[model samples]
Target: MTTSSSSPTVDHAPRDPADGRWTPRLVLILIALAWPTQLLAAGGILGANAIAGVAQAFHTTQVVWFGLTLTLVSTLLTPFVIKLGDLYGKRRVMLAMTALGALGELLAALAGSFWLVLAGRAIAGFYGPFGALSFAAVRDVFPARLVKQASGVMGSSVGLVAIVSPFLAGWLIDTWGYRGVLWFLAAATAVAFALIALLVPETPRHAFGSRLDWPGGLVLGGGLTAVVYALGQGQS
Candidate 1:
């Protein structure tokens, strides 16, 4: 009797080592992280066109503050935010940050006063380290082999966003007017927030009751703020 040879079976899907299940949520989180930088950079083009409307509604200084406010607040809060993520969970912190950013953009879109817009921007500054948090999440959730490739993808996306944002912002400004920039940012932020809330899972946290260096974080935040402030002022 002749026996037929059996065909080799192939595995179709890769598994995540952390949980033994690969997830599409990692890509979703990366896309969410990309939005913040793109939104912020895109809004820069609105300066010439949007500034006039803002000045008429409020004042010229508000225009300058529009650009400065988010950077300043983000510089001050980044360290504390990272520490908070370590203690609690990066996914939780990232979701909170995304929520804050969305709220800020919504406030900016609706605000009738310059001070309110500044308030929105300050809250929006929470987005600064989202990319880093996302990278950390990848490290925590993905195997070592995938981490490097995933990180390269993330880095490349930033460069791509840098190229796209200006033209997109300019077109929005030209089409709908200045508030369009804020509206677009708000919409993007809201969508990102939703994706994070729905798909991303909380990663492992630091050991329970670990000591946190609040003082060092504070100093770093303060020094960074000062440096950013000086640079922003020098640009004027």
Candidate 2:
């Protein structure tokens, strides 16, 4: 994950923030290198795999509906991820997103119910912050000067992959089946979580991070779950 220090030009040696220098070009490149992998872990592959089970559980007719439902719920949860970052720390938020995404993918792989699947999908969606946070992580890791360039590079890498993620995810599902795809995604997410643990460091910004807002998280998560479930169910 990232901290407020969103650039790649980080001082390996402890230096004052004022002394820390980052290059926009270098930070952008790191983000670019990391983008496709993040997309595969967070969106492109896992998302497409999720559709098969949702289709099987809810019917093909409701696949679109399920997607819509999940999207809305994700919208609800996404801000909380950011806000929690504001309150706590960005790295903590990102770790939650990664870990939760991994858990959700595994659960969905074994899901038995429409409700259960919805929950799993929601958990998976919680990890969606890779969309925004990689930049934040770059910001966290690098100096302020280079953060933008790094963002561009990382953004470019993933942007190119965006065109193909769906097709690739689709092929995996078609070739192997839903469970297989989920299992693979689960493994991928787990790896991602491990990488975050190993490669990424917690931000000093959140060293004295804000308290977790359990009530807010629950209330928001619950409301979103209800809305997504209803939409997936396609009520009149």
Candidate 3:
């Protein structure tokens, strides 16, 4: 008896439409978040040169120490800021960081001494919140499927900005000077901050606590400073 057997057919899942159409608002929001982050990080491209220029302005090498101090402090502060974002809202934390950075830039522009410049650098240390918290915000708002692509675009923006920031900083230094560049950066940062405040929605995800822990901030800041300083001095 020869009998022909029929095989069961497998079913496939539905796919997303490939219409190439996207919401303008979402795209614009992503661009806003990404572009400013790129600009802020790029703000550091000629950062070493800026410190040297500050050194010359003060007629001492201590300004370089100030820059290094800020870098160390900022590195230490990063985890705390991220944690804080996880506590409060990511948008609020990010806005605060951007505002602090802008304020620091403004202070640096007007600084008259190495100590004053160092203070400004220290003030600017919270800038890490932008990229990280912005990411948190994206995760809050966007679909899981799109978040990866969005993150990729944002990361690429940083690289693209890096390619241009140093040249721009160099030109600004030639044309206006370090202080001038600081002023420009400060103004631009403030504008960006304002844009974020106006446009971005606040996102509170996995943020449960109300009380901000000071001990965490201090321990994180001090420990990070020790480790990063060790590595930095090793490089030197």
lDDT of each: 0.70, 0.61, 0.71
Give residue 128's lDDT in candidate 2 (0 to 100): 63
Tens digits of per-residue lDDT, candidate 3, 35-152, equal 6678667776767557666767788945556557667767877777877776766777878888988998889888887788778878877774467677766776565677788788
Q: Which model is ahead, 2 or 3, in terms of TM-score?
A: 3
TM-score of each: 0.81, 0.67, 0.83
Error of 3 at 140 (Å): 0.9
lDDT of 2 by residue, 1-236 (tens): 86675432222312225434554444333634373245544464456555766677566555654345446656667656665655555556666777887898788778776667667766776776566565666766666766676667665666666666667677767777766666776677777676666555554443233566668877876687677667666765
Q: Please write out the lDDT profile of model 1 over residues 1-236, one tens digit for every residue.
A: 99853532222123354553335655665555555545554545544346666666675654777867888888888888877777778778888888888888789879887889889888888875576577777676556676777667766766666677667767876787668887887788788778767666676665335667878988999999999899878866
| Candidate number achieving the greatest lDDT relative to the actual structure | 3
Question: Over 4 Å off in model 2, which ranges?
Answer: 1-37, 40-53, 56-60, 206-236
Off by over 4 Å in 1: 1-53
Number of colliding residue pairs in each model:
0, 17, 0
lDDT of 3 at 54: 72
Candidate with more favorable, higher lDDT: 1 or 2: 1
lDDT at residue 21 of model 1 (Cα atoms): 39
Best candidate according to TM-score: 3
RMSD (Cα, Å) for all candidates, in order, is 9.6, 6.9, 10.3
Those runs of model 3 whose alpha carbons end farther than 4 Å from true positions after fitting are: 1-21, 210-217
